[model samples]
Target: MTRAKRRWLPALLIPLALVLAVLTGSVQAGATVSLPPKTADEVLAMIARTQVRAFSGTLQQTAELGLPDIPSSTPGVTPGAGTALEFLAGSHTARVFVGDPTKARLQIMDAMAERDLIVNGKDAWFYNSADNSATHLQAPKPGAPTETLPSKPAMPTPEALANRFLAAVDAGTEVTVGEASSVAGRSAYRLSLAPKDPGTLVASVSIDVDSETGFPLGVHVQAKNQADPAYSLAFTDLSLTAPDPGLFQFTPPAGSTVTTKVLPARLTPVPDADSSPKAPSPHGTRVSGEGWGSIVMLPAAAVPAGLTSNPQISQVLQSVSGGRALTSSLVSVLILDDGRVLAGLVPLERLQSAAAAQ
Candidate 1:
């Protein structure tokens, strides 16, 4: 495959992956219940010492990012991208079973169809019932390096998202504990993180931590000027017990088209001796800011030409002064005519300014 084709999948998957990272689990608010009052530092410590791991649960994700409604399947557009856009605009439910770090399964329930991601040891399978297609990937040999799937998103658990945010707590962020609440029928302490910078599109982030186990039960990200959460993922039902091992085993249906790939032990780099030292290489990515206002810039060569030419993508992007932009409640993406793409959890103006500087 050409470099452009290879880069296209990851480029298009970025937005969807961001959305999916915050998408999962459904919240069930119950009567206000009081838990032991703990300081922010104490709660942070609790999260750091969490030991619960194996569990099975039902997750629901919802987004109200002000994105235009797009069909799951668009003519002439890549099928995966179209489907990802559809998920970005709507709510989805999935069953998640995590037995350990290497054994897990996510079954996304779609209307009359289901998409599954099963990871068993070093073997992983992604199957889409709507298309009856499956992709199997095997990890590189022991003691060797590993590779990532460009097209797949490692749908995060609420605990994982909470840890990510907690790890980034800094002087620019304010951490506080809100009222105790309920999530997935369990009592949880509400931990809120608010950015001190007004320039960020994010208003605040709220995490519901299980009162007993310290496991994060839900995550809600609010955007500035948006009353509803830009994205929410929480469990409506949860089980602490380990799931059946059978859930991790997956077999493709009969007659299904299966593509199998064994990841390379090490990725070999192509030498580019003629590349200019002053200019960013097409494969190189750079960040243009910090904290919540950060903008990720992809070099023009890194962007796939097909992404810009896709009719479906164009329909959602509006013509701005310097480029076409996909503006949502919490994030903004700018696709310059020069093919470089910039995205961040900031305003379109921030992206425009970054592009102009480039």
Candidate 2:
């Protein structure tokens, strides 16, 4: 793996389709042991510890979300896999180092190449060795109550995935604790959640937390009516000590192409807002619904050429009425004839409903 590639892969790949897939059962570790079980109350308490903050370790990601057999064109482009098309439907490993909330490095290891995401405060860089390209972003200001990075549906790291599940534990969820287990040679507790909303396709989501630090060691998400996890991310090895500060810094190698993008400033509310009729915001891509059943809507004009021009993608689209609807065990996406795309963990009928409502 090149140093540049090590700085960008995790941020891009970890949140793609079925990025939540994880291995089931316990990893065989030496010496049998026992640990205390956690009650629902205790699990709730651990969920509140969202700022466990820093850790360094190796992450194993399994993505078998039942994605279609997407054909690859360029070295890193795979239509319909989102930005993580390069990592679609496979097993991969990456090294993660987080020194604090704003500084971290994730290096994904591949058999022939590597990629990395490196962030220090509001500066971030992504490099892919397979393509010899580096992307630089002037991240939106950090710590602003309203600031957010722009992306279709921002991908979250494994640590952030823990927080995502915790945030989903509302009145619509059923919570419980699983058996005590070991992860990365440390005692851990399993917390599980099942959505009560019939609109969602997720069967359940489970998190394994390190008993000592309250950090999530693994996450398993099962799709509705499926026997196996749709996606998961787990730590096979970990260390809680602070990582070296230098690990978060980055410099592109000579001969690598570099591109830069700056996020737009967030809009601020104006005074006397009620005095004037508000203008309808221009139509664009946005997500509807919430959590597991959430649907991403992309206006046809906004979709890239890869989605419309590819023959395989075209076949998938023309095979069914109302454009096209494709599904895997965990996810379903509907492309409407009007040039809009809807996707989520819900059934195709749900996506169709969302499109009709729009």
Query: Per-residue lDDT for 101-208 in model 1, tens only?
Result: 678788888777777778777677877787788878666656655544323334567886665555445667788999998888999999998978788788888989
Which stretches of candidate 1 lie above 4 Å from their native place? 1-25, 73-82, 140-153, 261-283, 304-306, 309-312
- Candidate 1, residue 49: the lDDT equals 84
Q: What is the C-alpha lDDT profile of model 2 across 209-297, one tens digit per residue? A: 77777777788777777776777777789888898999888999898888885543432322122232222223455556544455666
Clashes of 2: 16
Instruction: Determine which window of 10 residues in candidate 2 has minimal summed lDDT.
Output: 1-10
**C-alpha-based local distance difference test score of model 1:** 0.69
Task: In model 1, state the lDDT of residue 210.
Answer: 89
Which has the greatest lDDT? 1
